[model samples]
Target: MSVSLVLTVMREAVIRILVVSGPIVIVAMVVGLVISIFQATTQIQEQTLSFVPKLVAIFVTLILAGNFMITTLKEFTEYIFRLISGM
Candidate 1:
């Protein structure tokens, strides 16, 4: 493949990764920030307190977005394969 084609594929792969991961990362960040605020206010610095909620929130996000993420990945994979075949 040409350098331009390789770069295009890489760029598309990166964009797809960002699209797939953005929601879960954003939700976890927000949940973690809120939990930090609550911990600061209430002074309940339990270790599991931080871990559990973020984990649960991420899991929930994955559950809710799972189909969308899968569909996106499938499309990306198909596009990549087609690009390869075309080359």
Candidate 2:
């Protein structure tokens, strides 16, 4: 592929990755921040406390967004196949 085409594909891949993972990462970050604040206030510096809530939140988010995520991935796969066929 040409440099421009390669760049376009790379850019699109990055954008897709961010779109797919952004919500989960943001939720984890927010959960971590909230947990940190709570830990600071309560002095409950437990490892499980920090991890469990974030895991639960991420699972819930994944369940809620699973369909959308699948659709996005399917679209990207189709796009790549189309590019390959054109080539």
Candidate 3:
């Protein structure tokens, strides 16, 4: 493909990836921030305290958004395939 076409595809791919993972990442970041605040206040420095909650929140986010993520990826893949076929 031409340079512009390649760049366009790459840009779209990045956007798709960001859209798909944004929710999970946002949830994990919020959970981590809250845990850090709690740790600071309580002097509870248990490592797992921070890790477990973020992990669980990310997992739950994935479960909730799984279908949307899959659909996004599928559409991106189809778009790429169509571009290839057109070339």
Candidate 4:
């Protein structure tokens, strides 16, 4: 691909990734921070405390958003393939 085409594709890929992953990542980050604060405040430093809730929240978010994420990725993939075929 020419430089411009490559840049366009990369930009699209990054945007697609951020759109697909943004919510879940944000939720997990928030949850993890909250849990960490809770742990600190309560002095309950269980090694798994920070991890479990974030994992569960991420899983639930993924389950809820799975179809949308899949659709987005599929569309992006198809677009990429079409661009490749055109090239």
Candidate 5:
């Protein structure tokens, strides 16, 4: 591929990755922040306090958004296959 085409593919791949990951990341951040605040207020300081909630939130996010994520990745894969076929 030409430099411009390669760059375009890279950019698209990054954007797609971010799009797929954004919800889980945001959920994890929000859960972590809330857990931190709770710890600050209550002084729990338990190591698992933040980890468990964030993990659960991320899992739930993935479950809720799995279809969208899969569809997006499928589209990207199809685009890549098309590019390969053209090449």
Candidate 6:
């Protein structure tokens, strides 16, 4: 593939990854931030308090968004395969 074509594919791949991951990451971040605030207020420094909620939030986010993520990745894979076949 030419340089521009390669770059385009790489760019699309990166964007797809970010789009797929963004929701879970955001959920984790929000949960972490809320836990941090709670810790600050209550002085409850239990490690699992922070870890468990964030984990659960991320899991729930994945459960909710899993189909969208899979569809996005499938589309990107198909696009790449088409590009390869065209070459």
- CA RMSD per model (angstroms): 0.9, 0.6, 0.7, 1.2, 0.7, 0.5
lDDT of 2 by residue, 1-87 (tens): 899999999999999999999889999999999999999999999999999999999999999998898899899999999999999
Among these predictions, the greatest lDDT belongs to 2
Q: Is candidate 1 or candidate 3 better by TM-score?
A: 3
- Write down the lDDT that model 2 would get: 0.96
Candidate 1's residue-wise lDDT over 5-80, tens digit each?
8898899899999999999999999999999999999999999999999999999999999999999999999998
Model 4 lDDT at residue 3: 93
Could you tell me how far off, in angstroms, the CA of residue 45 lies in candidate 6 after the best superposition?
Answer: 0.4
lDDT of 3 by residue, 1-87 (tens): 689988998899889989998999899889999999999999999999999999999988989999999999999999988988997
TM-score to true structure, per model: 0.94, 0.97, 0.96, 0.90, 0.96, 0.98
lDDT of each: 0.94, 0.96, 0.93, 0.92, 0.94, 0.93
Error of 4 at 55 (Å): 1.1
Q: Candidate 6, which segments miss by more than 4 Å at Cα? A: none
Expressed as tens digits, the lDDT of each residue in 1-87 for candidate 4 is 699989998999999989999989899989988998999899998979888889899999999999999999999999988988897
10 residues in a row with least lDDT, candidate 6: 54-63
How far off is residue 43 in model 4, in Å? 0.9
- Residue runs of model 1 more than 4 Å from their true location after superposition: none
Please list all clashing residue pairs in model 3, or write none if there are none: none
Single out the weakest 10-residue window by summed lDDT for candidate 5: 53-62
Candidate 1's error at 46, in angstroms? 0.4
Q: Judged by TM-score relative to the true structure, which candidate is superior, 2 or 5?
A: 2
